[model samples]
Target: MTNDENQELKRDKEILSHIQHRYDEEERRFQSVDTKISSMIGVLAVIFTIQASLFINILSNSKPDICLIVLFIFSLALYLISIYYFIKSHYFKKFSATPKPSFLMEEGAKKESEHTIVKDMIALYSDCINDNEKLIENKTNIAKKGFSFLIYGGCLSFIFLLCFLLELFV
Candidate 1:
């Protein structure tokens, strides 16, 4: 190969390396989102447990206050919405992966020019990166909504606890 061809080949290799690195980074990012979602679900489970106990306490009272009952209902609704969103965010999403070694070998054998092979691989990686970006953004938005609802539900539950305490002590 001529010097110019050698330089071109080197440049293509570098570009391919960069794009592959980006694809790997995106995969890690996707996994990070999944981890966050799992943590949120765990927290939700704990909160749900606490809320269930409080609800039972309210019901067991001889004279349950209508106002408290209404607050509990609203709070319960918010918690349900939050859990729904969380589950949606945690739903399985198929992500594009890099080509397997066998596929790479096949492509290498079929392509006459290494440059063309590199270019094709780069294109594949780019497409996978784009697809993963969209999915990650969607999951993040849904998780944010779930977190907001969780906060709202938690605040209401706290208020209910305060009222119950006041009623009991005074």
Candidate 2:
């Protein structure tokens, strides 16, 4: 009912809104990362299916020469692409999104000095949050790149296998 009480309530509401926004942003980033990873896994699964079918077809057709060569090339390409993706995912997840140390220290003297220190601490925390956002963006970019290449590589291998099968049977 009081004016001061209303002002305090308004400030608290604003702070709560800001915190919710940050949490929502973080959750969205995490979901984006998860989606990218799931897509990459799907791509890999398709590649493996193709490879398996190629192997079975090659063995069943009894034409080892041509089928073997095609399979070898396709497998080699997939292997190389997998290695690249592995390295990229490894590095991105390992180095990115590392939280930095807070700037608040325990050595401030006097009330005014403590106030300034608290302000600095808040600024540092904000900077860290910004840094985390940038890191998430970087991770998303890396995942997107990896997923794109994975899809391309998987499709290429699948097509290659299909062509080989067609050539063998027809």
Candidate 3:
């Protein structure tokens, strides 16, 4: 092959390598978002347990305060909503990956030029990257809403706990 042809082939390979790397990076980012969602779920579980136990204690008392009951109900409702969103975000949605091996093999057997194959693969990689990024963005937005609910629920719980303590000591 001519020197110019060799250089062009090398450049195509380099471009393919960069596209593959970008695809991998997007996958890693998706996993990172999953990890964060899992962590949030864990914390919510702990908070739910504490809230349930405290609420039960309050309800069992003969003279349970009406305000405490209302606060607990609101807090628990918010937590449930938050959990729903968190679980929704955590659901295993399908991600776009590279073309299957069989397809690649078929392409190889077609006797297509290497440059053509590389360009096609680059296009596939770009599509996958775009799809995965959109999924990640959606998950991120859902998680943010869940986080907001969690914070609001926590505030309600704190108020309930403070009132409970006041009633106990006074």
Candidate 4:
């Protein structure tokens, strides 16, 4: 190949390699976001356990306010739905190395050409990368909703605690 042709081939190889790397990175990022969602759900579970204990303590007194019970129930339901969102977002396939072919077909006097196979593979890989980017975008939106639920649930819990304390003194 001439000097210009060689340079062009090298550039194409670099671009293809970059795309493969990006595909791996986006998949890894998806896993990271999914993991964060799961961890947040775990934290909510622990907080709910603590809140249950507080709720029990409040009932041991003369009488718990009906509003306090209602708010706690609402908070629990919100956390439950948020956990569902986080779990629902974990619906993507992980990318892995393609397996080596066990055998190959032969033409009248030759096997399949490597160039065509590689070109097709590169096209498929590019398409997968695009699809993965879209999946991650969706998961990110779901995670944001999960975060909003956690915040609102926390606020309701705080309000419950405040009301419980106020009733104790009154």
lDDT of 2: 0.58
Candidate 1: clashing pairs of residues: none
Which regions of candidate 4 deviate over 4 angstroms? 1-5, 91-118
The digit string of per-residue lDDT tens for model 2 on 1-170 reads: 57976676566556545654674577577666766666665656665676667666666667556645665566646645664664465356432221233222232333444334444444544565576677677766766566566566666666656776676688
| TM-score on alpha carbons, each prediction | 0.89, 0.58, 0.90, 0.80
Q: How well is each residue in 1-170 modelled by candidate 1, as lDDT tens digits?
A: 89998898899899999999999998999999988898888888878878888687776874668777877878888888898898899895866788768869889789668888888888888888999999989999999999999999989988887887777787
* lDDT ranking, best first: 3, 1, 4, 2
| Per-residue lDDT value at 124 in model 4 | 61
Question: Which portions of model 2 miss their true places by more than 4 Å?
Answer: 1-20, 31-61, 64-76, 90-122
lDDT digits (tens) for residues 1-170 of candidate 3: 78998898889889989989999899899989999999999999988998799689777974768998898899999998899899999994867778879869988899998878887888888888999999999999999889999999999989988998888888
Residue 51 error, candidate 1, Å: 1.3
Which is superior by TM-score, 3 or 4?
3
Q: Is candidate 1 or candidate 3 better by lDDT?
A: 3
- Candidate 4 lDDT, 1-170, residue by residue in tens: 67986676666677778877887787688778878877887887787788777777766765887898898888877777777776676554444432124322322125445444445556766887777777788887887887788788888888888888898887
| Model 3 ranges off by over 4 Å | 1-4
* Pairs clashing within candidate 3: none
Better of 2 and 3 by TM-score: 3
Residue 80, model 4: Cα distance from true site in angstroms: 1.2
